[model samples]
Target chain A: MTTTHTSRAAKRPATSGAHGRHPAKSRQRPNWLGGLVSWLWLAVVLIPIYWIVITSLKTQSNYYLTNPFVPPGDPTLDNYRLVIEMDFPLYFLNSLIVAIGTVIPSVLFSFMAAYAIVRSSGANRFLRGVNSLFLMGLAIPLQATVIPVYLLIIKMQLYDSLTALILPSIAFAIPLSVLVLSNFIRDVPKELFESMRLDGASEWKTLWGLAFPLTRPAVVTVSIYNALQVWNGFLLPLILTQSPDKRTLPLALAAFQGGPYGVNVPAVLASVVLTILPILILYTVGRRQLLSGLTAGFGK
Target chain B: MSAITARRTSSAAASRGGGVLPWLALPALVAFAVFALIPLIGVLLLSFTSWDTLGEIQLTGLESWRQVLTDPGLPHALWVTFLIMLLSWGFQTPASILIGVFLAGHQRYRELLAVLYFIPLLLSSAAIAITFKALLDPNFGIGAGLGLDFLTQDWLGEPGLAFGVVIFVVSWQYIPFHSLLYQGGVRQIPRSLYEAAELDGAGRVRMFFSITLPQLKYTIITSSTLMLVGSLTFFDLIFVLTEGGPGDATRALALDMYKRGFQANLMGAACVIGVILVLVGLALALLLRRIGGRDPYASQLEGA
Candidate 1:
């Protein structure tokens, strides 16, 4: 469907402009609108985050009396103490268990599947079909399938357990992970594989020795991505698990906000802060990998 | 014994130069089939039977569908869902593009802004909804503290304002992600096009429209598809934020399903809603792909 005119309309520049690193270095015309919107959007994003952090530090009484925009006059960790006292540590551990449980198997299996799909090189019908199945899986909303997943979990007697969360999380993570990992795997040089083949290396050996090293960054990206999804997942825990002890951070956060402690705004915001702190730390540690991987992963 | 024989035969097939690659995909395939694919079909089947969460399912053909279809709530839920999908897409697209174009600049400050901008995306929807819920409280919220009477409106208490709040919060969480996509898209645009336009004395606005907008067609499609389809799963945020609001004003289809199935104990009815949700998502995705004007099954599977 791409007409000649349409294809040429936004075609890549013929010169040395590779992947838009430095777009128009000479045409330094000031972008007033872009600048204005950038700064404005920055405020819109930051103010709430800023409010959440500072307000979390405030006493509930001070939160009521003080200028909401201003930093707390007297800071307190009482809210944090209160939130932690409410078994947040349990929820945090449950989230951690679920995240780790989901990420490892999900990433490993997806990596294996992706390697198979990429290695088949479009010649293998079964691999091609599997690849397409994963692609179709991407478009299916998780909400649509939750009902039966719930039933399956119950039937398996895995309901109300962390394993219940882990199983479904692994399935949901596979499609996107396979897509991204396969894309990365396809970029590995065919010559390398052929060279391994010449040395009488098994496909599994080449997969581990060559592709694994080359695609480690993608693996990390997929790991962090899946970790985030599982860590922040709300619905599965909301429905599958019933025990208070089995609550993940998100499900626990919702419960904390809606429970009898709901009226304690400081404690509520404190719990929110607590739930986000671990990911914030992870983000800080792997900002570039996470951000760039996300950008390139989706912006193709 | 049967499992061993099957494995032996598969290994025999694999050793015959058919390659072991296909076998490597088995774990993921089994997992997806059990938990995702089967559940998809299971949901459809469940819609034909009636079961509360704790009970034995009863096969009662189109009865559940009939009840769901007759209910006035279904239309309202669909409308609310459609409104959120449309409005959120409408609101997020332009802003994300502008900010994306802005962040595409290679300035140090813009880099810093990009860092902070993505923080909201890092927060779980539950966290974002909870934060917004507390922050927008009419009595104990920012408006009361700042003494801004206009801002002091019952944000989540009133129906219209609650719907608007839901859309705004969704945008606040997602625009960072879409803008990041736009930034990457903008970064991929050929610089020479801008150079050519510049030589012709094109202004910033002119270059953006003539060059940037057209070049970003695919990114727009990618982001739009995620936004439109992802809005269908806006359960946790809406559930936590307004619980579908004062009078079901913000009750989306997913939330409606949850209330019906989990709260009201109508599993069959909920499955019908789930079926509708699946169909709508598939239809929208196909529609967007059609608009993209590519081979329907083309291998451009780049998304989060």
Candidate 2:
């Protein structure tokens, strides 16, 4: 690919004169209209987020009476304070634990399985069959599994614990993670692995030191995808955890919003703002990596 | 110390006997078997039996299946689910493609717009549902503030409007994903193609239709299928916002399954719904694979 890019660059000079003859005037109208429409569409897409943030910052009185488009007349931190006081911190921590717990083991196990499947000799067909089986997981919607999952959790005596959340979350994540990671690991240049083998590296060593490093971006992408799914997940937590202390952020937020304590709209929004902060920060840091990571399997 | 050393040596020797690779998958395979596959089988079996939460399982044969098929609620729920899927795909896919094309050349603002559009994807669906619930509140929401109170119909309460609201929320949450897919597809086209089209005095629209859309066919099929499957199985946001209320107007199959299986403890009926959901997903997946002739993950794998 790099060679192709360089070769293409070398070929550019012969076409330079023809390209130079193209008038800027001919392109200006489309570019201007395109720019304007893109910006307008972006604004429309962002309005809900803007509304959420603005509403979160508003005072209770301002929430009901102020113009929703405008900034609050007297913005207050009371809502955030209230949410914190309501022990949102605990829910946040539970969510963090579940997300990280699910991600780490899910990635590790899937990486190993994917690596073995991709690199093992004479098993490509068998591995593809395995891959298709895992793909079936993608079709099995969570609603279908929730009852059985609940039953299994009960039978295992793990209900209302973080284990109940972590175990199923990891199970749900593994099939897709393995599918993604195996595809990625399969794409590692065979020459690199052969070179590593010539140097007397073991299979595990080659996978860990060579293939894994090259696949870090894909790993991060998969991890983030898995984390987001775990974090935003509601049904599993809703059915599995009966205790408030065991609740995750989404389930906790639902409880806060729906409870008989009367609707504290500002605080609910504040909790949302807080819940969304980690993902936003992660996105800011890794937006490009995320895009490339997400598009890894896009084209054939 | 000597015993431990000998044990470690024996284990190492055993690992060298071609068992290491299979052992590596043991944890994952076992976990999936116990938690995912076994339970799924259990649910399938349970679907054929009559069992309340408190009672013993009894073979009911096809009774539950028949009831689920004949249930009035099932058809309505199926209809709502299909409508949401159709509406979301109908509106969001074209809009995303247009936005993706429009943003392709303008690299400067592309990152910014992508970030903004992706905000909903990052936020919890429950949070977004609650936020929209507030925003669409008839009495004091932003809708009323904008004097579009006429637009402030009970978004989650009015049967006529509830499905539309759910579709909008689902589309809003996913538009970024499709846009990102299309953007990547557009980026994959060699810039030289566009330049050549320009040299031929082709308009931007013509260039896009002639060059870009064909190149983006794979992405379009993939994103549309994803959106369809996603909308079909969707539960959280609608469950949070509407609870399938306003007379089951917004009840998707997944939500209906939840209400039946867990809320009502009608295990057999819920499992029947589950089977239907799986069938829908498989059909969509097969359709996508047929049209796109490529897996969505294939490109990501190569890039990796």
Residue-wise C-alpha lDDT for candidate 1, range A137-243, written one tens digit per residue: 98889668899999999899998999999999999999988987887777676667767776888878978899989989789888988888888899999999998
True-vs-predicted CA distance for residue A185, candidate 1, Å: 0.8
True contacts kept of 2: 0.45
Q: For residue B47, give model 2's deviation from the true position in Å.
A: 0.9
Q: For all candidates, state DockQ relative to the true structure.
A: 0.44, 0.33
Q: In candidate 1, residue B26 scores what lDDT?
A: 92
Alpha-carbon runs more than 4 Å astray in model 2? A1-28, A31-37, A121-126, A295-300, B1-19, B294-304
- Per-residue lDDT tens digits for candidate 2, residues B197-285, read 87888886777689889988877877876788778778889889899978888888999988888788887888888878877887887
Q: CA lDDT of each candidate?
A: 0.85, 0.75
User: Which parts of model 1 have CA positions greater than 4 angstroms off?
Assistant: A1-29, B1-16, B295-304
